[model samples]
Target: MTAFRIALLATTVLPVLAVAQQMDPSMQMPGMGAGSTTEVAPPRTSAPAQAGMNGDHDMGAMRGTTSSLPRRVGAKRAAPSPAGPLASHNAGTMDGMGGIEAQREMPNPPPPPAALSGPAHAADLVYNPSDMATAREELRAEQGDLRAYRVLIDRLETQFQEGGNGYKWDAQAWYGSDINKLWLKSEGNGTYRGRVEEGDLQVLWSRAISPYFDLQAGGRVNFGPGPQRTDAVIALQALMPYSYNVEASLFLSNKGELRSRLEAEYDLLITQRLILQPRVELNLSAQNIRELGVGAGLSTVEAGLRLRYEFIPEFAPYVGIEYERKVGNTAGYARASGEDVGSFKYLVGLRSWF
Candidate 1:
C-alpha cells in the first residue's frame, strides 16, 4: 500500500512541471511556482517617437538633457526674428516698414516749366542775351544804308483833242526816306492855237499816313493865258482797293477861292503786257472865279478809256477816246465864251515813268 501511494503522487507532479516549462516566460505570472521572477520594463518615451514621425526634431535638443515638459507634436521652433521695432510690422501693412516707406521719405525732383514742356510751346522759349545781341549785329551789318533820293516822272505824255488839238504833261520828283518826302510836281496843257491853256507847279511835303496812302501839303502856282494864281493845297493820294490809283486835292486860293479835284484810274490786264486803263477826273468849285475860267459847283468832268501794250515796264503807248463836259454855271460860262459845253476826242499818247 505505501509503494502504491508514492507512485501516484510522482506521476501527477511530473505532468505539472512539464506544462510549466512549455509556457512563455513573458506570459508567466508571478508567484506561479518556485524560481519564477516578475520584471517591469522602463516606461517608453513618446516624445522622441513623435519627433521622429514629424521630422522636426532639433539635433541639439536631441543631444541635450531630456525635458519634463511635454514637447508639442509636429510643432517647429520659429526662425530668429528680425531685431528692430519696425521688424515686427508686417511687410504688407502700412506700419512704415519695408521699401515702400523708404521711397516715401525721399525728396522728388521738380517738374519742367510749361514753356519747355512741349514742341508747341517753342514760341515761349528764351534766348540768351549775348546770342540775341550777336544776331542783331549781324542783321544790321547785312542791310547797309538806305537811299535818300528818288525821282518819278509820272506823266510826260501829250493828249490831242479833236475840236482843238492840245498837249499835256505831268511830272513829280521826291527826296528823302519812305516816311517823309520833299516833292516837286508840275502839270500843264497847251492849245493848238499857240496858247498855253493851263499850267500848274507845286512844291509839297508828303508823309506816309497809311500803307497805301500819302498826305501831301503844299503850295501851287497856276500860270496860263487868263490869270495867274497861287494857292495852298492839301491832297491825299492812295493806291486804293481793287488796285485803283486815286488822288484828291483841295485848293485854297490866295484870293479865298476854294476849288477841288478828284482823279482815279485803273488798269485792267488783258494780257501780261496788254492793259486797258480807264480814268476819270472831276473838278469842283465853291465860288465863281470867272477870271480863271472857273465857276461854282461842278466845273468839269473828263473820262477816258485807253488800251495800251506795254513793250517795257517803264513805258507804254496808248490809244484812247476821251469825253469832257462842263456842268452847272461852268456850262453857262462856256457858252458865254462861245466854247463848246461838251467835246469828244481820240487820243494817242505815251505813258512813261521812272
Candidate 2:
C-alpha cells in the first residue's frame, strides 16, 4: 500500500510541472502578463463551411480577397450589368428622316391656258379674287370646244336639200311650157333646118343618186300640134361651185318611136342663191320613121341658157333661152333646102326636193 501511494504522487506532480514550464514563453511576449498568459495558436486551414465553426476567422477573410470578392456576397460591389444589344436601335428609327415639301423651285410652265380643271370639279373650286378672271377665261375656251364637237357630229348625221353627207334620194315632178318650138323650115345643100313651131307643154320626173350624180327616167309628154313624146334619161351632176351635168337617155314617141338622146349642162353658182345653167340636148332615131317631122331617121341638137334663183336649198325657179337644129337625108328633102331654126325661149319652173 505504501509503494502504490508514492507512485501516484510522482506521476501527478511530473505532468503539472511540465505544463507550467511550457506556458512560461507567453509571459515574455509584449502583450502577455505574468501568471496570466493564455496562448492563442495559429488558425488551422479548413473547408469553407468548416472555417466558421472552427475559430479560424482568417479563413473567412481569405475567401473575400481582391480576386475572389466579386463572387462573395458583400465584398466589392458587382460591375454594372451591360445594357442589352438592342437598346441603341430606337435612336435610328427616325433619325435620318427629312421634312416634307421639297418641290417649290421647279422651272418654266406655259400660261394663259384654257380650262385648268374639268367641268365636274369646277363648281367645287374656291378661287381667290386674283384668279377669278383667269378661271372665267379658261371656262369660255372649254365651252367653245364643246360646241364645236356638237356641231361637227350634227353635220355628219343630218341632211339638207342640196346634199347630205354625199347621199341623196328624192322624187321630183316638173311641168313646163315652151314659149317657142322648132319647126323644120328647109332641107338645104348639106344640112336640114327647122323653123319656130307652136308652143308646147313638157312634163317629166327627176331624181339624184348622190351629191355627185343624178338620174332621170321619165316621159316628156308634149301636148301640142307635134306628136306627144316620152324620154328617159340618166344624168351626172357635180357638186363643185362650177357645176357640170351629163346625161344619156332613151327617147320614145306616141307613134311607137324609139330613139336615144344625150344631154349635158353646166352651171355657175354666182351666189348661194343664184345659178346660171347652159344645157344642150341631142337626139337620134333608132329605126326609120317616115311619119311626123322626123323623116326616115332624125338627128336633132338643141342648146339653152337658164338662170335660176334658189329661194331655199331644195327649190328654185328658172328662166332660159333655147335654140334647136335638125339633120338627116329625109329631113333635107321634106323641108326647104338649108333651112334651120333658132329661137329665144322663156321658162318658169320649180326645182324642189323632200
Candidate 3:
C-alpha cells in the first residue's frame, strides 16, 4: 500500500514540475520556494498593457524590451533611438515609435547670436530726420554751384564749290554755368591759294531761352577781301526736333546793310562709327551792297552731304559733295563779276572736337 501511494505522488508531482518549467522564465510558479525569486523575476506588465492603462505608450520601455523577444530570421527590427532617453520618453506619449523617428529627423534650432547674423537692433539702423535733411541740402547746394565750359569747332572744313577749292571754319567757345554764358564766335572762308574770301568774328552774351535753345546778342566785325564792316548781331542756336541743329542770325551793318542767314544740319547714323550729315544754308539781304557783291532779295543757297567715319568720339575724317548757287539778283551780280552763278564740288576734310 505504501509503494502504491508513493507511485501516485510521483506521477502527479512529475507532471506539475514539467508544467512549471514550461512557464515563462520571468514568472515564478505558485508554491515555489521564496528562494526562486533570485533566479526568476515577476513578469513585468507589457508596454502595450501599461500604455492602455495610462493612455500613453512608453517607447523607451518598448525599445528596451523588444530586443529580448524571439524574432524570425529575416524580420526587420525597430531602429535604435539616436536621441537617447529623453527624446524617446517624449516620443512615447506623443506618436509612438514614429514619433521617435520624427524627433530624430527634426531640424536643429538656430545657433546662438554671432557677428553678421543681423543688425544689432532696429533703432541702430535708423537715421535721424534732421540729419538726413541736412545732408540733402548740402547735396543740392553743391549741384547748384556747379560750372562747366565747352569749346567746339562747329564746322572746320574745306569746300569744293562752283568757284574754286576753298576752306571754311566756324567755331564757338563758351564759359559759364547752365543759365548764362560768355560766347566767342568766328567763321571764315578762303581760297586754296591763300586768298581770304570772307570772314567774321563776334562776341556774344548767351542766355538759355528753353531747354534746347539759346538766344545770343552780340557785335560782329567782318574782315577779309571786302572792305571791313562792323555790325550788330542777334542769333538763335537750337537743338531742334528730330535732332536737327539749327542756327539763325540777323545782322545790321554800320553802313545800313541788312542781312539774314539760316542754317540747319542733321546727322544720320549709318553705324556706330559711321555717320552721314546733310546741311542746308540760306542767305538773304534787304538791300544791295554793290562793293560787297550782295543782292537785295535772296543772296545764296548752299546744300551739302558728308559721310564720315569716326575713329573716336572727338575726331572724324569725311568726304563730301556740295552744291551752291547764287539766287535772284545775286546771280546777276556774280555774272557781272565773271564768277559762276552755280557750282558743284567734291571735298575731303577732318572734323574734331575736345
Which candidate achieves the best TM-score against the true structure?
3
Better TM-score candidate (1, 2)? 1
Better candidate number, 2 or 3, judged by lDDT: 3
Off by over 4 Å in 1: 1-145, 148-150
Q: Give the clashing pairs for model 1.
A: none
lDDT (tens digit, per residue) of candidate 3 on 1-354: 999999999999978656644554444346655345333223357888656654443443453343333333223345656775355355455547877788899999777766457654433458775676687678766786456778887677877765467888888888886778889999888998877789999999988999899999999998887898999999999998889999999999998889999999999999999999999999999998888888898899999998989999778888998888998888888899998888887878877777
Tell me which of candidates 1 and 3 scores higher on lDDT: 3
Model 2, global lDDT: 0.47
Q: Clashing pairs in model 2?
A: 181-197, 183-195, 186-336, 187-335, 187-336, 187-337, 187-338, 188-337, 188-338, 193-339
If the candidates were sorted by their lDDT against the true structure, best first, what order would they fall in?
3, 1, 2
Better of 1 and 2 by lDDT: 1
Give candidate 3 regions above 4 Å deviation. 1-141, 161-163
- Per-residue alpha-carbon lDDT of candidate 1 for residues 111-214, written as tens digits (9 for 90 to 100): 75964567542433476656767776676555632337655555544566666688777777888666788888888878777887889999999998998999
Error of 1 at 166 (Å): 1.5
Worst 10 residues of 2 by lDDT: 149-158
**Candidates 1 and 3: which is better by TM-score?**
3
> How much lDDT does each candidate structure score?
0.76, 0.47, 0.79
Model 2 backbone overlap count:
10
